[model samples]
Target: MALKMARDDLTEFLAAEFPQVAQDFVIEDVAENRIRVRLATQDRHLRPGGTVSGPSMFALADVGVYLAILAMIGPKALAVTTNCSIDFMRKPAAGADLIAECRLLKLGRVLAVGEVLMMSEGGDAPVARASLTYSIPPE
Candidate 1:
């Protein structure tokens, strides 16, 4: 399906609705069945070993899929995460921005399923993979 919420629409919606975290993420690309999200890396997102923290990666995965769902379903603020599973594969480069490519596998009335693959900017291999499910609120 085509995106109801494009990059600019999603960005503005997040800015207006989730001002708290609006600056942390950027909607890099949005298209039919796909979305690319970036976590604007900062010192606070780095771990002790100078690698991107797990929590930061998780945030990217969560929001990536969340925005993807919103793209298909429009700005549904009530849709909330129901489950998530992530695997941290390789260490993320500390100085590089992290990118998440998300694809919606299913978009049903009550539930949505999607997966995200995260990698460091300019890197070839994936640093983490995540699967997420969101519960779409009733109308």
Candidate 2:
């Protein structure tokens, strides 16, 4: 399917609608059914061991899928997550940003399903993987 939003458009939309977390995520790339996002790791995102926290990784997956859906379906800020299953496979690298590669697995009128694989920057192995289902609001 054709893309409804580009990287810049998604960035602006995120800033306008979700100002609270807008600064934490960077839209790295946007394609048809995929989007890459980076979580700018900060001290607040670190755990006691100085690694990125699970909640922070989960946020990256969540935002990545949300933006991927919006890119396909236009600026539907009301598209909300209906279900999510995330696996924390390994520890994230210290002092490195987390990258989430998200892809839309299925898109229908009422729902969208997607998966996100997260890895620490410069790391080859995945740190986490997530499958999510989002409920698209009626137009």
Candidate 3:
């Protein structure tokens, strides 16, 4: 399937619909079935031990899938995450930005499913993995 929305379109949509977090993420790449996003690392994203916090990582995974869905379906602001399961496999680097590589596994009339592989800027292995399901609003 072809991408219905481009990177700049997605960015503009995010800024208009979710301005609070529009600057926290960057659209690294967007293709037919995959979308890559980067999270800007900052002190607020770190935990007590100077590691990226789980909630911060979760946000990456969530937004990754959300955008992946929109990439194919266009900017459907009402599409919402229904379920998410994330596993942190390793600690993220203290100051390195986190990257989320998300792929759409299924996109149905009412629901969409995607998986995200998250890693630190230049890490060799994945730091976290997540499976997310979203409920798409009817047209």
Top-TM-score candidate index: 2
Off by over 4 Å in 1: none
lDDT of 2 by residue, 9-70 (tens): 99999999999999999999999999999999999999998999989988999999999999
If the candidates were sorted by their TM-score against the true structure, best first, what order would they fall in?
2, 3, 1
TM-score of each: 0.97, 0.98, 0.98
lDDT of each: 0.93, 0.95, 0.94
Clashing pairs in 2: none
- Which pairs in model 3 have colliding backbones? none
The predictions' CA RMSDs to the true structure, in order, are: 0.8, 0.6, 0.6
- What is the Cα-based TM-score of model 3? 0.98
Query: What local lDDT does model 1 show for residue 50?
Result: 81
Task: Give the 10-residue window scoring lowest on summed lDDT in candidate 1.
Answer: 87-96
Question: Over the full model, what C-alpha lDDT does candidate 3 score relative to the true structure?
Answer: 0.94
**Model 3 residue 54 CA deviation in Å:** 0.5
- Which runs in model 3 stand beyond 4 Å of their true positions? none
Comparing 1 and 3 on TM-score, the stronger one: 3
lDDT measured at residue 52 in model 2 versus the true structure, 0 to 100: 99
